[model samples]
Target: MQDEEQDRPLLGRTVGITAERKAAEIGAALPRRGAEVRDGAAMHTVPVPQDGELRTATESVLAAPVDRVVVVTGAGFRGWLEAAEHHGLADRLVEQLTGAELLARGAKARGAIRGAGLVESWTSPAEESAEVLERLLAEDLRGQRIAVQLHGEPMRAFRDALAEAGAEVLPVRVYRWTDPEDLSALDALIDEIIAGRIDALPLTSAPAAANLLGRAERTGRGEQLRGALREGVFLACVGPVTAAPIAAAELPYAMPDRARTGALVRLVADRFARD
Candidate 1:
């Protein structure tokens, strides 16, 4: 019994998960380390490949030659191409993008661009949208037609900043983040967090973190949730981008040196084991 407990570092710990796409994978991983996993997907990714909004955006991009293109996320960039292919504009769209200066926000986006046979002229070292914006702002973007691939939500501020810099910005929203179909699980998870029943909460994306915080605020337990997080519950974020919301709320969190899910899992296990 003593040996088993030593091997299972998280034997007495309960961890909450807020990922929709990778929930099963993460849930399975935590249990292997002896954690009681609580699954509560806070947001859902709704693909808009065939939607009118995406089509219109695609059309606008193809209407004229774009001078620059910003790839924000790998999935979003891939989905945008898939949507273009659905509209029979894949070949032409690819040709047009190939001629433009491509800027990838991170490694994932860079990989997606390379997979599509497109080369990125620049890649952000920090893997942040803010860094992408800063790079664009440094250049004189007067009269430049730029297309920005949005990930899961509209980046109004990002687009607005570009427009302010005298560039015509076109936003391609390949998908949007919506509340999960069932809120019971998420609500229950929130309750558990507020009551300090959960030891740690792991977040995979910015939208999920934002949605969780938004839900708590809507239920008038925002302060309670923040207090609980500050007092007892350990918050683990996958990466800096995913940790933005928590930072905005003035909450402390732990992030792995690498942004991969496996690294995140190890970070959680090691943290608990050390504690």
Candidate 2:
């Protein structure tokens, strides 16, 4: 029994996941590697209520030729195009986008652009929005119309920067993040983390990380959670973007070289094996 346990590094360990989209997928992977899984989706993702807002933005983008288009996430980019198709504007939108410079924030975004039969002018080397913004700011963008596809949340700073640079900004909000329908599971996971029962946590998105920390603060367990994290709770983030909130909290976390979910799972397994 001891020898077999040695072969499975994650055996007997518990890992908590807070992503709603692929919680089941990630949860299954952890158990296969011998770790117990706890699924507590911190937030839920819903398509932007098609209440004309998205259509209005689409129409605006098609109103004139855009100088640049920013793709922030693969799913969001795909969703935006689908929404456009529903409004009978997908083909036109794609044609307009093809004429402009496309900036992809990461590999997934790049893939989405290519899948749409469009090529990105450049992809951020760090897969960070900050890097994307930096690249745009370095250019002269006055009087340029730019469209930015938003993921689950608004990129206020990124949009503001472009607008300040004298460019007309059109934000395409494909989806929005909302609190989970059921808070019980998330609350229970919070309890487990505070009690140090969860050995590690694997976070896939920045919204999930922020939502987790926000929930802890709301429940008056923020300090306790921070203490537990500092004391030795392992945090495995998919990438730096997902680690931002945790990093701002001055907590330590490990990130995979690549930002894919599979890489994140492998990172967790490798860390436990090393320990």
Q: Could you list the CA RMSD of all candidates, in the order they appear?
A: 2.6, 2.5
Best by TM-score: 2
Give per-residue CA lDDT, model 2, range 32-112, as digits (tens): 889998889999998986657788888999999999999999999998889989978999999999899999999999999
Per-model TM-score, in order, reads: 0.87, 0.88
Local distance difference test scores for all models: 0.90, 0.89
* Worst lDDT 10-window in candidate 2: 1-10
Spell out the clash pairs found in candidate 1.
none
Clash total of candidate 1: 0
Which portions of model 1 show Cα errors greater than 4 Å?
A: 1-7
Best by lDDT: 1
